[model samples]
Target chain A: MNHFIIKNRKDVQKLSTLAIFAGKTMLSNGAETYRVEDTINRICSSKENIKEVDSFVTQSGFFLTLEYEGEIFTYLKRVKDVGINLNKINLVNDFSRQFVNQDISLEKGMKTLDEINNIPGYPKYLKILGGSYVSGFFSLMYGGSPQDFLPSFIASFISLIILDKLSKFNLTFFIDRFIGAFLSSLLAIFAVKLGIGVNLDKIIIGSIMYLVPGVSITNSIRDTMSGDSLSGLSKGIEAILSALAIAFGVGIVLNLKSKGWI
Target chain B: MSVLLQFMYSFFATIGFAIYFGAPVNSIIPSGISGGASWSLYYIMFSILNDKILATFMGAFLVGTLGEALAIKYKKPATVFITPGIVPLVPGAGMYYTMSYLVGRNFNKAINAGTEVFFMAAAIAMGIIVSTIFTRTIRRFKRQN
Candidate 1:
């Protein structure tokens, strides 16, 4: 006996939308493509409402098919503005778990998803302060002397501010990172030239950690190891590109300095 | 000791990064600890073995392991912790040096630095893969038991 629950088209739409909402949250918040696909599968595997879900996830969007009561429904969600917001990922993961356990109603679920999706990130002030700490301490660890600490910290703080301001204008991610990195290295070089720091290399490296693709590279490795080859490759490429952009930004500034153009 | 101090600094740096990464409030401290431990492990391993890549691999492995354990304990995904944990081993310095040399038209140094960065990235990937496989097998064993 085939015992899949009968769901109306309206119900299918709601549930699929909810699943897509969860998926968009995951993708936007830096969840690997495989994790996003698994979560979608779990959400759609409700014995009561749906029988199966086939989902295809990429770096930018997702396509999902929901099969229920001998009917098929498909959804395509375009994911824009990808950035790391782990809090959103955790929230979506929690909501998905609750949903899979049949602990939340459809309307309630929709409401919660919207709320989590719109949750405010940490304040800019705090972000700049954190950047300061990263630059100041990482420089010391990277072999910079105490004199370089203040320069690195100041440079990184300014870079974070520039990043925040530029991103607000809805600029592309590459440009945002490129310009953020350019300002960071420029500041570091200027500080070193003016006797603010002895080690330009260490200071520049320290400040650029804020722009490094550390998290992305780690996720790419995890995704690849877990057999999500496409996701791994896409994320790996993204990491490389971002790393290259940072390098380019720094290189430009250093070249100008070397050529007495700065 | 200075190693301990380095650990604390790395710890503090990661906490800041965790916040910026928007880690959940409760997991923030644990992620920071994970990041710091990974960095300090690399430092200690490098001091003993005098090899940057080996130290990075060991540190990355431990980071993956710790991240898995924390993910289980907190009922959250492992990426939450592991993403920020490997910051210290991501070869940011190597990438910068390579670019610097390349821009300055120093071909030999650029090649050396670029190759070093490439290898370091590979090692970090290897380390994460090893630990992820180990953890999956361990989890499966528990399930079988």
Candidate 2:
């Protein structure tokens, strides 16, 4: 079901705003340039607060940014947690970036989650599931090169359609994220090897984007910068450990390829 | 054509990538413009020193100074523009290439690449730290006043 809690107004707004920026940043693959602009825009919009707001992403364990008044924060993560959701983030970021050139209202873009949540006739649980799926798929295809993007775009759409058919199984989000990334990466790699012109590096990194633990990476950097070495070290350690987990997961498939077991 | 336009285009492309990565909108364009102008220092330094690294440092210093001015002017964080502007200098692709070479067991190539990566990362880090310290000192001075 839609987990719509009426948090105290400030916190709720903060959470939603953070989610929007996090989602965007997540998609951009944590490139510094995009992040800088994103922070400036967010902070500029929130002129009244003039206080520090820290945002953490759960999946990536990365801190997006720490804003005190209007300044953005930055640092290198102690760990890397590459995964499929990172793909989803890129796709969404691409879509938004495309719209950046269009005349669409930013406020409307900002309200996408709420709009998805309040769709009529769909079961609340179904709506949430559907929204996540759509969002995931949209994000995966958004940031790719135009020509190569078509197939991944088509593949993502097809996967979501197929996923919807299998939704009755009620898998947890984490399980689905793993399965989705695994299958997508599998197809993406095959597509690249089979005479398609897609760049392997882009495919691997793009698909893994969906699952990278960005929040943790950002947090690790932030804690370190703020002189809380222990907190930073722990956060950095956690991020590094997660990166190993992701590398291992991808490594299994790569190993199979090496062993002629694929 | 004007030298300024070249810088503007480069700056725009840089900021465009930054926005794509998830920077707040307000910071991207302005930061980019400022980043390009920051290169002016390097242009001037090249004329005097004729040294690439020294020129690079001078340019970066100017960019950092400009970044501070923008932050104060916009009443936003210095990082919003500074991070993205300096991104062009980050050794990301170099680091990736070094790691790839090491993985492939090309020891000679890897070592060469690795050294470049180390230097680049260190320089970038130093630039950031220097600017940050500069800003902090200014802030402290203001408070003392």
Candidate 3:
């Protein structure tokens, strides 16, 4: 086994660093933990001298081990602010597949990996427009009158801006969702109070739809069914926590209304 | 007319969601189609049969199937499309109702709404799983052949 270990210390160091980069990209971009682990394994296995690789990832961080030349190296990486960006996930997936398929040099691979990690996230205007579109259409689909469309769009747009601004504070996701949903509900209620919207409830619901963690919930289900139990459970908890946050925000408003406090 | 309205809204909504999630630009339309088709299927099945569970199940299955095909064609994973594509079917209204009723201290209504959300979510998940198995099996068979 040692005879086949042609990779020297420098090569092993490069491999470990490359693996860490890929792992960070995947974990930070909200890839399933098992997928992160799988990608790391694939990237490392591309090197002939890499003997064994094992990785464990959660929503928070990862512990990875690599063995080569009869020596084992371990690394721990912290993951934070895991947001969903499918484009990054796809590019990294493609890169990892390319890495495993052939003789891409370590330097070239690192450059590609850096590019994948640095690809710009969604544009600012796009986030606001996307938020408006989702809320507006969702309101209509949920049986809101045509009168509610513009109000829903406006409410969601404002909340999106607020949400983006709050994100810069590096607050936890719960606070982000809570504040965003609260603002959405408040504005929607104001629209209704002005006699412009027919269904206050529908508008509120539609606007707060932006706060729902649909992606996390859907991915958790897929992850669980795919047999990655811990990853599934962690993502499931994330989705549930976000849901609770949204409900908290909306509940404060509705509870006030029910009590004639507002 | 109502069905068409629902379809169009879901289509654009899914596209918007895809953008927000930063999905690949070229696959956005396909994801939109998946969302539109899922809503249309659910509407048809629901109108004809008055069955929410079966309707959502079939709808999610169609969305998953479409996502799986689009994933293969686009060289991306099925999840990229599926997550955004199924946004239209996530029982948003049910969740809202549950929250409102709970807030209002209407326990019975809250329970009703909550159960509906639970069932709908489960149906959607089951549908996706079933369709994933279908696609995986077909791909495996195709490779073997």
Candidate 4:
């Protein structure tokens, strides 16, 4: 592949914008901070005559600067709606690698990125089925009897549907997780009372497993290990708060049960 | 028998989570393998050592190493595998119990569970870090040779 040449200030600006756009896509889709920084630097530096590129990425946003022909350009983007979509991250990762290795034009690159951004996640029914599988199997793993499986599945299925509907309201992640957990626990208790579930604790744990901050904990540790302490700290706090939210949701139900209120 | 059952359960559970997290379809089985293997390892270690934190550390390390290997083989980022693989080992039960004890006004048990939860999380982090360092050192050694 021929080397992409940097011809003018416009080219440099376009390159920087492309790099930032790629980074934003990755970051919003749950790539680690250091990986985003690396992708931005790699893409920016891929072209000839680009003298330098530096990128600073965090969990929330990123800043990138590029130098070409004694001129410096900077792009700062504040990313919102940070959701876990590993497919998008994978696509963007492949896109960046192709951009660096092949002589892809700036316009084509932007178009490809836009396409990646527009790709929808798995179908909603499949995701709900996945949710039920997770909760059902988790309860079994937690030592729930065979009878507990159906109840756990039913509880998580309803709660996941509710959570999916709740997403449209644009509520904070905390409230979303809190309500998910609360609803699941309430359903679990009802299932046990109805003799559908044999173990309340196991069912509750399984249902709430969907709300646990698994991605945040993994990403925070990874970011920290790779020396991105700022992103790591923030993500760690996010993990803790989300866990607390889940706990609070469950605890309320348990307290009510003990008080004979539910 | 129980261990095998746990393995199968975790495998499917992890696959479910992998799908929910939008992992690529081609990568789902590998992530499930990593998750199931790590959880079984944790179960065995926990049974032998009777220590939750240490067992979790062992589990996380296995997941990290396996994830890195799978990432290299599949040419995808390690997080794709590691994220789903580590979820089963996360101390969700600990978090729940701690809050339950606190709500019950049992400060002593709450502190106990809370401290264990904190250390288990730290152990998971340390395990992943150590595995990463180990993999990096191996790569460096290969490069030097």
Winning model by TM-score? 4
Per-prediction share of native contacts kept: 0.74, 0.00, 0.73, 0.73
* 1 versus 2: better TM-score goes to: 1
TM-score of 1: 0.95
Lowest lDDT 10-residue stretch of candidate 4 chain A? A1-10
Supply the DockQ value of model 2: 0.05
Sort order, TM-score high to low: 4, 1, 3, 2
Q: A257, model 1: CA deviation in Å?
A: 1.2
Candidate 3, residues B1-145: lDDT per residue as tens digits?
A: 9899999988988888988888888888989989999998998898999988889999999998998898889899788889888888887788878988887779999999898888988898899989989999999999999
Say which prediction, candidate 1 or candidate 3, comes out ahead on lDDT.
1
Per-residue lDDT over A1-262 for candidate 2, one digit per residue giving the tens place of the 0 to 100 score: 1222223445444544544553544422432223323443443234334345444433233344444435454422222333122223333444444333444333454565344323233233433333233223222222235344434433344444454566568664445544554555566567667756265444443344333333444434433554555555665565545544444444455545556666
Each candidate: how many clashes?
A: 0, 46, 0, 0
- Clashing residue pairs in candidate 3 (N, C-alpha, C atoms within 3 angstroms): none
Off by over 4 Å in 4: none
- Compose the digit string of candidate 4's lDDT tens values, residues A1-101: 42778788888888888898899999999999999999999898888788778888888888888788788888889999888899899999999999988
Best candidate according to lDDT: 4
Put down candidate 2 lDDT per residue, B1-81, tens digits, no spaces.
334543643464345334433445566678777656654444456457875356555555655666777868865545555
Q: How many backbone clashes does candidate 4 have?
A: 0
Candidate 3 chain A weakest ten by summed lDDT: A1-10
Across A1-262, the per-residue lDDT of candidate 1 in tens digits comes to 1233435787778778888989988998899888898888877776466766799998789999978778888888999888888888888888888777755767788999999988898887987787778888888888788898899999999889877777778976677778978999999988987988999999999998888777688778878877788888988998888888888899899889889988
Off by over 4 Å in 1: A1-7
Q: Judged by DockQ, which candidate is best? A: 4
